[model samples]
Target chain A: MTDSWLTSLITATPQEGFELAITLSRRGVKYTQPDPEVLHRLRPDYANSADSLTAASHVIAVNFQTVAAANNYWRT
Target chain B: MTDSWLTSLITATPQEGFELAITLSRRGVKYTQPDPEVLHRLRPDYANSADSLTAASHVIAVNFQTVAAANNYWRT
Candidate 1:
């Protein structure tokens, strides 16, 4: 849990930036729910739910926003 | 590009499934725009836009839905 996967958000490309955004979101979820068993148990309730999926996407987008800001929107 | 990062969508845990969903969404984008330069150029256009961010989120949600179905909603 202490291992750092994120060294920098300043990616050389948008693709990397987007990937970083996903990583950030995933890490956030892991931080919030460190217990894999509990997360697995709760998966059924939210997996098929459109609302939950949409919510997950929203979180990713927010992460993307943060990454974008960090990278200055990849502007030269 | 030939190296496969996706082994399975049937994760042992929901967290893993969610991460896979994010990967799927990211891969989709990469497929759509193989050129990093083009994607980077496009970043500024969508980076600060609420609609664009929301759109990205929606895409992730859709990918999540696919992963959920593939994993049978993680119902064991």
Candidate 2:
């Protein structure tokens, strides 16, 4: 398999993120909690919403081999 | 504290992400591995960049208490 990947974000309550992490990991899908620093650097909207974002919920950054695959995983 | 928050994404190599996770966690920052399904659902660009993004590196989603805090963490 290639060593490249794409990234996406999912904002959810800490409770939901915790549950999803378990679900995705069991399915052999890869993901990570975004580094607030890194997120601030990459996404402007994230930077703008920092306080609200951190105070209430968490952000999850997911990886995938293809857009279709990522879409399928999320939608399904 | 209120229970609402925003979200964002950061794409990087797996190596860098691992290291940053260590650094942030040690500093008392909370984070987690993202669920790819969740990401695909949230960010459309991520879906669009799937091929190139997955073929190159990983994505990181970070959280913070404020925009300035997130910026300070990432920039420093």
Candidate 3:
């Protein structure tokens, strides 16, 4: 696992594609189906590309305790 | 560059160390320092290890338009 999470995609048009990407991001609600412990929510205020939200890899978000608990639960 | 950013650190104790690490994370303000365009901010609500923050590698936060703009500015 390396304690990392990564996801990537190449855009045909960096600008338009980025807009679409973020738009889709906004369009999508943060949810963790099958894993209730994990609640995926985008960092608001980090809205605009110029304001916040830059070109970086996958975002890191976790409910570690829940994750650990869930992990334990599953283990049990 | 592979269009990616990466940073990593190994912890001695995953639990206590994780708390300390996140405490340090909370203590620090999101700043780009030299690169004003690259605004760094954490995804909130994602606070507790069980709440949101997980043992994932570094988080990704960016202001791409500013990044591109700043990039162009520096290039000019």
Candidate 4:
């Protein structure tokens, strides 16, 4: 948590930026939880549930919108 | 995949913006890998790897940088 991990988000392409977005989302969960045991234990509750998956998607869309805005919607 | 889930990234606060960033990351995964079974099957491989988890953080940092820049580093 103390280590410096980020370098830049000015990706060469939208595809890379999109992949980075996924990583950001997963990392966010890790940072918020920080405990693997708890995360694993709770996996079952959401892994098999469609609702949970959809909710996860919703969260991603929100973040994507933010990223899109940052990159000016990847205007070229 | 075509539900049009995003509304806006102009969050009321940075905390909300950060949360949105996480959501965007997760959603990106879903979009990239629509098959839940595949995602579930591959989960165990990285779930326990510290390197994978750290990498996730790096990704988050990258996306976060994008978000930070978008928000002007959340400057007042």
Candidate 5:
């Protein structure tokens, strides 16, 4: 995504990103994509699992959308 | 998925499936989950790339959701 494209989301708690999403939300106004290794481990336990995290919905959406894009790229 | 778990989708024309999806949509009423090889190739070209197909929204959704699930499982 472009730089300004990500400025749109409002996380319930900025900290929920790292706490619930395993993301580095506390660092800056800009979000670099999370490390691939971290992303690998932070996946939802099941479909819609991230729906329950109150403060990290944006992170959850980011996570799901990234994977969905990758999936769109390589179906397998 | 269970036997009944797959009875949910309605692919239009049914024949457009194999054409647009690169899938074997004609054989049965139940969806067996496309082959891993075929799945790998039929993925949308971009985020929501499959949105253009007129007869296969179901296939696109299935493809997107499958990759999303796989992404949720592996994260990386």
Candidate 6:
């Protein structure tokens, strides 16, 4: 039911995580945090610290048109 | 210098790729094709078929706030 074509799962400190979200929001890109249970099921390796999800690095999702463009924005 | 915090490298057929791009564009998201040389250097495993890059599923990077969000959009 979603219109998003691609998603990016980024892991970063809480500060960086929110910063990226803000940046995307400013550009009018939609993004959100993955559900903890779902994330744990999908990527167990990175989901070791569920409690630390909000304090440590977190994942972010957004829609994009091309790989190159996504990369540029992700790095930001 | 980019605002993106994470990147997703999606692999789908050409039709699917363009379709996703269109979907994102309609949503006002920005995306582009990764530089062939840069993509090869960054991900040698997925760069085996440079010639087929356009024909095969391509990578699409984007910024996100959480892993869950990225996963949802990616599946779309």
What is the C-alpha DockQ of each candidate? 0.04, 0.03, 0.06, 0.08, 0.03, 0.05
- CAPRI accuracy category, model 5: incorrect
Per-residue CA lDDT of model 4 for A4-48, tens digit only, reads 666766655445555556567677898999999998898766655
**Interface CA root-mean-square deviation for model 4:** 8.9
Off by over 4 Å in 6: A1-9, A29-76, B1-76
> TM-score for each prediction?
0.48, 0.18, 0.21, 0.49, 0.19, 0.21
The top-ranked prediction according to TM-score is 4
Model 1, A1-76: lDDT tens per residue? Answer: 8886877778775557656766787678889999999878986554443344445556655666566567655544
Against the reference, the lDDT scores of all candidates come to: 0.63, 0.31, 0.28, 0.60, 0.31, 0.32
Tens-digit per-residue lDDT, B1-76, candidate 3: 1232112122233343344434323222222112333333244323334423332234211222222222232342
Per-candidate clashes, comma-separated: 1, 24, 13, 3, 1, 20
Model 2 spans with C-alpha error above 4 angstroms:
A1-9, A29-76, B1-76
Instruction: Give the best candidate by lDDT.
Output: 1
Candidate 5 chain B has its poorest 10 consecutive residues by lDDT at B24-33
TM-score of 1: 0.48
Candidate 1 lDDT (Cα, whole model)? 0.63
- True-vs-predicted CA distance for residue A33, candidate 1, Å: 1.1
True contacts kept of 6: 0.04
Q: What's the residue-level lDDT of B76 in candidate 1?
A: 77
Which 10 successive residues of model 1 chain B have the least lDDT summed? B1-10
Model 2: residue A47 alpha-carbon error in angstroms? 40
**A9 Cα displacement, candidate 6 (Å):** 4.4
lDDT of 5 by residue, B4-66 (tens): 222211234444322422321211111212245533433342224443233343434444343
True contacts kept of each: 0.03, 0.01, 0.03, 0.10, 0.00, 0.04
Model 1 CA deviation exceeding 4 Å by range:
B1-76
